[model samples]
Target chain A: MTATTPAPSAPVAAPEPPVLAAVDVTKHFAVRSAVGARSVVRAVEGATLDLHRGRVVALVGESGSGKTTLARLLAGFYTPTSGEIALEGVPVRQRRGRVERSYHKDVQLIFQDPFGSLNPLHRVRHNLERPLKLHHGVRGKAELDRRVRELLERVALTPAEQYADKFPHELSGGQRQRVVIARALAVEPKVLLGDEPISMLDVSIRLEMLNLLDRLRTEDGLALLYITHDIASARYLCDDVVVMYAGEMVEGGPKEQVIADPQHPYTRLLVESSPDPGRGARDRDALFDADADGLGEPPSLIDPPPGCRFHPRCPFAMDVCRTQAPPRADLGDGRWARCWLHAADRTITQENE
Target chain B: MVTQFVPDTDRPDAGTTSARRADGDVLHVTGLTVEYVTDGDPVRACADVTFTLRRGEILGVAGESGSGKSTLITALTRLQRPPAVTTGGSIVFYPRDGGPAIDLVTATPKALRALRWTSLSIVLQSAMDALNPVMRLGAQFADALRTHDRTLTKDAAWARAAELLATVGISGDRARSYPHELSGGMRQRASIALALACGPELVVMDEPTTAVDVVMQRQILAQVLRLRRTLGFAVVFVTHDLSLLLELADRIAIMYAGRIVELGTARELYDDPRHPYTRGLRDSFPPLHAPLTRLTGIPGTPPDLRRPPSGCPFHPRCPQRFAGCDTDLPELVTKGGHSVACRLHEPTGRPDPVPDPASGPASGPASARTEGGAS
Candidate 1:
């Protein structure tokens, strides 16, 4: 017998373009120390990208690349020092919104470690039920329990009977992640913000968790912002990719376009640097590190690189590149690259590699 | 014919094969059983796992968490403590002098210490954590040598530490540096030097390169290969990165639910993996170079070690699981040269009867996807 299930998400009407958009967004953090009077950690310099409806968008970069800072700004956990952040066509209230708690239901975050994210004393049911009881106005133990179980099942922690009763320590890394997923899905949030979802997990089991998330985004139609240092995982999961360099969107586009035909030097360096099971014989280490230094001192954002913020590390940097800030070029087909090479000539795309 | 620096692979006359004769393996582990004693019931960390590490050869053990890989390493190193008891097994260390091989399992506490660092050592994952933040790099190296060899004076220990610094690719200046001062790559190098302080014959490294950046990891791998060339000691290299293991390891072993599921030379395991679990694992991650190719991740999660599946630990996820798999656990039988724990292969003969055509997407003739690792 054929079955027809009710459509999961709301009907597409006005269809708000991108739940969140960074219009030339730049978040500069002032690092005031005893030694330095005014030094800015350009944590996130002129970064711009948009998170659209029902797709996993990966913000990939190394440790000091400002990926986390961007996530914080998007979460409204950190107020951007500069650059504009728009949510649903309306500018983010210029400050960490006073209605953050209320807005949290729409945009929920899941941390890297499930053990660290969930409290030890509380059970899985506690973590899941709290979001439902608070966000959905579900009162009564029975209703909260039923909803929590449903949430667990949605993330594929089936039966929920066995898992809901367990504590954080009792579950495996993968299972704990599923619980975290269930908790994030509790409020029926439109957006899911995942920070390194499976780094600490067993390498073999990591794929299973990634597949689960993929199903959620496709089936439930949830907008996902995947933040990670591991580029390989990002390549596997994200539909579209954003490469962040010292807190700026150096390159962003559809996964195949960006990953296959990278324009920005930083994006090329990052993709080349990470070890992929697919990339053969090429000494990835020498390919990436032989040129750029590993997370070497990023130029101060308060006083960003004289012209382009990336000129300092750009291998193909020229006098014009150093003196003049290159405008971001959207090279048709959802592909946008911020580089002098792209702005100057399309055919001159290949790096000196 | 004298055996030189040979890999642990089955092939005789292989290019890298050393002229040195096999001295009955440097490290022999048989029926190793370790259990973490919970409040009442003990969790089987490693059960009936068996393997051998030959002299001047690298043996790679790979598995997801709770696969008993770390437990097996811990049992060998005398690191497994009270809660994690070595229920059974004999970890034998074959000395160079033809002296009776020492059983690490029943060795005296004092003997265990004497054997450690000097004869058997470990290069741990997170060299930052392994190194004391407060102590200087040289000081920590000296401490390890002095603690192990009381005969060596302070001056002699200092000189040896400096030499070790050079051996591990760390400069003399780095000796005075703290763990924080050295970069991730340098710190890991120092840790390898520390493990090599007493010129250990066997080194047990657990995820040594997992935490570091890709550049540092490559540097570390190259350094390990260089050191092994000069030092002539066996390494028990453990990690989850199969591709890296394939590149570095001479022989590879796959662990699953507290037992060894498959063991073979790198060429054999990567080229023609026999076990369905091993095959599924190798196919999971995306390769680095090829961007357009679609990656295929395994569908299901590994079984819990606490109460693993009835028979085969991988039965639930195994694509070609048979009826016997539900009732009985198969032995880790040897086929050709590779050792695998799957009933699908006939232990008595080479080819086994093919069952269920609709089992898996990749159940074609073997060696279909066994070419180059990178797409």
Candidate 2:
């Protein structure tokens, strides 16, 4: 796939059609301030990405970076103020009743908090069976019973009978998370959107969930859009990586390239800041202070900084960076970055590196 | 009273004067047990926990949800509300400025009020609730300060509050604004500043950085460490992130099912973990610098504290569990400063057993693998 083909803008040669694609998707919300002044919060600004079948694309960013807003946009929960989200090359339209049911079946979202997502009042069997009946019309006591047990077993919640009768509060954190995953899979969605799925889980059991997601991608051929702030886990579970800073896609490419050789300054700081114990005897005090004066907190979305939204925190801001937005710089071989430092016309200075 | 299992050898921190009890020991917790007095049954939230905090040293408590990390902190500070009761053990606070060691568990209400902010303080997990929404940041700081030291004038308290806010990298002027006006990072910084208002000898922080972004989390931790070094105070940093503790803490205690499963220095646990659960936790998260490899996740869930496992709490999910692990409880044995309570690390049969640090995926132990291959 890495033939190093030359292109002026955009990467990825489109080896296969995207199962789900967002073309320059933008979502804005009008928020009223304490002063009664109306302003539009540019939560997601013109972000474009694609999810290919059987592949995992990770959306990496800090809080208020609009990564969650982007996922919600893809889930058809929010209508894009500007662009559009398409599934299998067809634009998704808002409809009533059963018409939206098929679209919901095609795309499923797994939330971060397992405890809040599941219903505390209902038993585990009902949680899985409700989705199955609503989506697939699997009726009758026997049919519902079989499908419910199968869903539980699919998520490795066994013995299935024991877990099926128990309430959500009775299950462990890991077990509850598994049940959530099972409910998501009950609909048999081709595109699975998970927002920080394992962040709330324990370290000892986080890998189990990741491996389960990876297996689902291979066996069920599901396309995954994994969103997380943890860079190491993204590289571990994903094939492609997208780095977003303040509602803008800064750098993205194959997971290895983005993680191994990060181009954007923000991406570099994120990779360096993620704690890794195996690195051995690092002078941490000095390392923490090195980036102290580099970048400020994420700018306000209602009135974000002009030009490159990251310029305020970006260590290598320039006059042009303050004045104009940077174009996507094509690094070829499916690798690209959105920073003025990588612009072809700009003269590369020592400060840029 | 619960039967306490103390480490059976001399600690590695015994040599340094800073590690000695007479000079630098700030807090000593022994056989601490806490239970939630529910209608059905008393649930053991924390059991038989023991550890020592040295002056200016950061002791991290790492565990998953339901592991009683939060319960331990709440009980140690004598802040447990109704429905939660400390059933056993004691917490002794050794004051640094030539004061008698006070027992927190049995202290009188008057003594506790005197000790609240002057000698001990807490940085609550959520920064939002830590400050009153109706009160301004300056007022919050001033309230804590004046409550402890009524002799200080209001003007003097405000001045100190401003100075403390500045110490945590927030502007002194922002203290006049209400909590809602400030950003999350600023509010968290203010809460930290409020915690340091009285210059307590020991600060108990419960996931202070979990609410913010990674960049801000690192910044807050760096600020905390800097403040600790300058103020000469110890810290009990509690969080679910073991990886973060690798760089932040001098010593770490890994908790599982209400018990401290392993206690050791950061380097010792990271390099040569003796407990299977500790090894599982170490390998669970992928390292940023290391080559990409499949991780081995520990299967099963944390035991129900109400009816915890009979032997080692981690035995059911342990990848290398043997007969003794499920039946006979392993006492915590000390090797230098690192203490582990697993059958493999027990000194009964094996004088020297090779620890498999390699994170193999769901595949059992090396012996099990070889046996399977031969069969």
Candidate 3:
């Protein structure tokens, strides 16, 4: 049965060229107050990342951290305020005709809420068929039906005949999400970006979805970007991690290194705040009072902190962190962190313990 | 020590069932059932649910979306409106400060109005929608305060309002700002402050942190814990995220298909889960420290309450299902410090042979230990 199934995504191979790459991208929205003075809401500040085939890189951050805006920039939904994006080494342009169509065909985005994303009135078959026809130009009644069934089967929605006739409301949450995934796969995109794809799902089924995404990366070689606030799932599924705070990338490295020994104070707080089942109640009490270690909210994006965006909430904030922005200090072995604490000359002082 | 559970033999009753309260229990719920009366068969949103809320202790209610967590909260607060009815069970709320216990299920509207904000209050989900969008944050507090106590002057009420906001880490001056002007985290903190304006002895929070980001959620939870410590009030925290409960709750109740499947301390539930359904839920999320392994999601969706499964509502999806599971209902029975409602722990109605003892307590292996307690 596995041999009979057709490949639904790009073929996997040794890492060579990146499927998607963004160079110092930025997105800003200008807002005018009631008095008419204008200011830019820096939703995303200069960020760089690459998505390679057969790899998953996660964009992890809290709300208002500009992760979503960055995802939109890569998906071609919005052109960057500054910087550029390339698809398979070719610069992506805001042009009409063949360029736009080809760019969209190679990239697909699966939204957070499956219930909201899928058309309520449309049947599963219609939702799957429409995307297939629009993207791949599949035609004729028999061929369309065959393609639709194949799409469902590829997503593990077996007995495609049974689910093809049901509407979005008729299926369960997990099943609905499967349908959404199948629709994204229908185009056979080289890259997939999921923005909190399983946040709306039940815990029991969420792991299954994450596993499915990992399987796609391993088997189909799709360059996947999983954007989420929950770090546990990011570590569980992704090969690399990028931690964002207030529209800035605070840390980026391999998942194991970053999670094991988070260098940035913000990254440490995130790890500390996340509820781990292995720990006991004393750890929880410590977590509750951990704010005493450093207590502040994310600064306003419109007027972020002058130096480090996270300095306002950082425990290890130094005088330099308040006056000058810290450079991305390379710790070698594909690891780096944005913090004054990692400065080359400064003696390492333990702030968290 | 393993305790064998004995199933309740009483015949099923379709109407309200009165329950005796446990001492020190702020709220005692027994056999609570709620149904949404739509055009078709009524949706049994909550069914035969039972639990106890202790004074000054944080009790966490964990469940999935359709598991009746929200409906159960509404039923407890006497906020269930038309199209939704509390079909059965009693909600006994013992007023703190040595006042008389009141049955909220049958409480008159006048009595409920007096009870709200003064003795008990609710912090609803979605802070954006919960606050009055057009009104200033202070006026909303004044409105809640004045509606409950007409004796307090407007100036005095406003003064108290500022104090409440301060308690939740919000500046008192921001009370003048409209709901839109405040950030999401600030608005949520203000809403919690308003809920505490009357110094309610018990606060019912329904997914109060669900919409916020993780960092904000952590801050809010920390503030709430600090406030609870200072004010000496019990809290009933409800959310679909069990991991949060494990971190915060003194006691945790796992609900499924509107039933209390398991009730125990956070340590007990996390380290030694009794019900198979509870085990499945605990295993659902990827543990940060545990070795990477494939998670096994429970098969099949929650059963339709209108025509719920003939026997155990979870039998269809339970991995340890036996011949008796499809026909006999299991009652929540307490042993040691925890309670479980699965046939695996029950001593009687042996329709399937028990598993080997080496499999551990989560499975069917059991022997000595005695006594029972209501869920």
Q: Write the per-residue lDDT of candidate 1 for residues B122-180, one digit (tens) a residue.
A: 98998888999999988898899889888988878878888888876667777888898
Per-prediction backbone clash count = 19, 0, 0
DockQ of each: 0.27, 0.46, 0.38
> Candidate 1's residue-wise lDDT over A215-291, tens digit each?
77778878888988777677677767888765667777767667767889877756655655434334433433322
Residues A10-71, candidate 2: write the lDDT tens digits: 23334667888887788889999889999999999878888888888899999999999999
In angstroms, the error of model 3 at A8 is 29
Better of 1 and 2 by lDDT: 2
TM-score of chain B of each: 0.86, 0.89, 0.88
Stretches of model 1 off by over 4 angstroms after superposition: A1-16, A28-40, A94-98, A140-146, A264-266, A279-353, B1-21, B38-41, B96-100, B145-171, B287-301, B348-352, B355-375
- Judge candidate 3 at residue B169 and give its lDDT: 82
TM-score of the first chain alone, every candidate: 0.85, 0.92, 0.91
Candidate 3 — which residues are off by over 4 angstroms? A1-15, A281-283, A290-294, A346-353, B1-22, B356-375
Error of 3 at B240 (Å): 0.4
lDDT of 1: 0.73
Docking class of 1: acceptable
Q: Model-by-model lDDT, in order?
A: 0.73, 0.81, 0.80
DockQ of 2: 0.46
Who wins the lDDT comparison?
A: 2
The order by descending lDDT is 2, 3, 1
Query: How well is each residue in A229-287 modelled by candidate 3, as lDDT tens digits?
Result: 98878877877789998898888887766777898888888887787765644766576
The true-versus-predicted C-alpha distance at residue A304 of model 2, in Å, is 0.6
Error in Å for residue A194 of model 1: 1.1
